[model samples]
Target: MSSENDWNEDLCGCMNDGGTCLYGFCCTPCLFGANAEKISEKNCCLMCCLYLVLGSVYLCWVPHYFERQKLREKYNLKSNPSCGDCPTTLLCSPCALCQEARELKARESVQRSALKANNNQPVVSQPEANSGEADHVNMRV
Candidate 1:
């Protein structure tokens, strides 16, 4: 609650001589005025160090963070790749097994389809022989 006048008076008394206060807080102009430019230089150096450290942190984190974010946006909602919907049988559909099985299945299905198509052809009919000559003679008469 001290007034400005009292503060100024204290400052003036502390600076009456060229000497500084016992605690080194007050002087003719200022206790730190002699080294003001040095203080500013040190602050600038500290700011540069802070900026360098922060830049390094940001640079190191950017690629991984962006890649992870992209992956999350791309595949986050998908089902587990390790688990499939349909049950895995001895011979799975669209199976990840060897190519031989798939090729064999394809060949078998093609052969079966070809067989079915061949069997679907129309049959040729022929006339039957008469059991007796009388029947033939009666028909002729």
Candidate 2:
């Protein structure tokens, strides 16, 4: 039901979401950990530790590349001919991680909205007023 020729956001669109941009800039390991967790449906701490430890040895990119490829395939994303997972993950690790995080975040939000709509629930609930009357009640003398 999804197209395989497009990415939800451009690689350079890291600043589109301030929170994600900040997290990616300040703590990339944490961002990657969160992304990996979301993608694998695993524990965030475990993913974070794995990334941090293996990433230090330079072989971590292998796993990251595979994960990125998996995400692209799962989401029906267009493959980057010039800059595939290897180069993207190895050369520009932060940017690649940011892009993946953005994609996952967008996908989750879209799914949530779709589910809410399908359930016939308002996206935002309105508070009910008591007594169906104005707040200005007159006191009888």
Candidate 3:
């Protein structure tokens, strides 16, 4: 789990980022599933289907709520006021999904930058003994 925090962006900020919001809005199921997959490493197709299927009953928020809660726990995000997870997901699923997508994007960017920084860093090799081998072996593909 990550450290305690609030959502990177508010749920209502769905349109704040531009085309990602548009993509999320246009493909709500896909966004929901992809966001869920990012949080749980589960098959996005299942998530997508869940949204499409359960959506008819207007209760797609059931699974979405659970996934949102899991996302909060995974990210150590403080639940929105008044036990906001279920409400946010339930009341406006698209907005919730968009928020989750933004969060995932932010996380991915952070990870990419960190990985790139590590790759750019000079590797400090330990002094090699007479074992005919270096202490560390780094092979870049």
Q: What does candidate 3's lDDT look like per residue over 1-141, in tens digits?
A: 446787788888877887778978898888888888899998999999989999988989999999998998888888877747777888888888888888889888999999999999899998656543333333321
Candidate 3's C-alpha runs over 4 A off are: 1-3, 131-141
lDDT of 2 by residue, 4-35 (tens): 66888877888888788889878877887888
- Report the error of model 1 at residue 130, Å: 2.9
- As for candidate 3, its clashing pairs are none
Count the clashes in each prediction. 0, 0, 0
Q: 42 in model 3: Cα distance from truth in Å? A: 1.2
List runs of model 1 lying over 4 Å from the truth.
Answer: 1-97, 125-127, 132-141
Instruction: Report how far residue 1 has shifted in candidate 2, in Å.
Output: 12
Clashing pairs in 2: none
Candidate 2's TM-score:
0.77
**lDDT at position 20, candidate 1:** 35
Better of 1 and 3 by lDDT: 3
Which scores greater on TM-score, model 1 or model 3? Answer: 3
lDDT (Cα, tens digit) per residue for candidate 1, span 1-141: 422211111212433422333323322112222222122222433433443354455442232223223322332322224532222212121121111122223445777999999899998888676678668888898
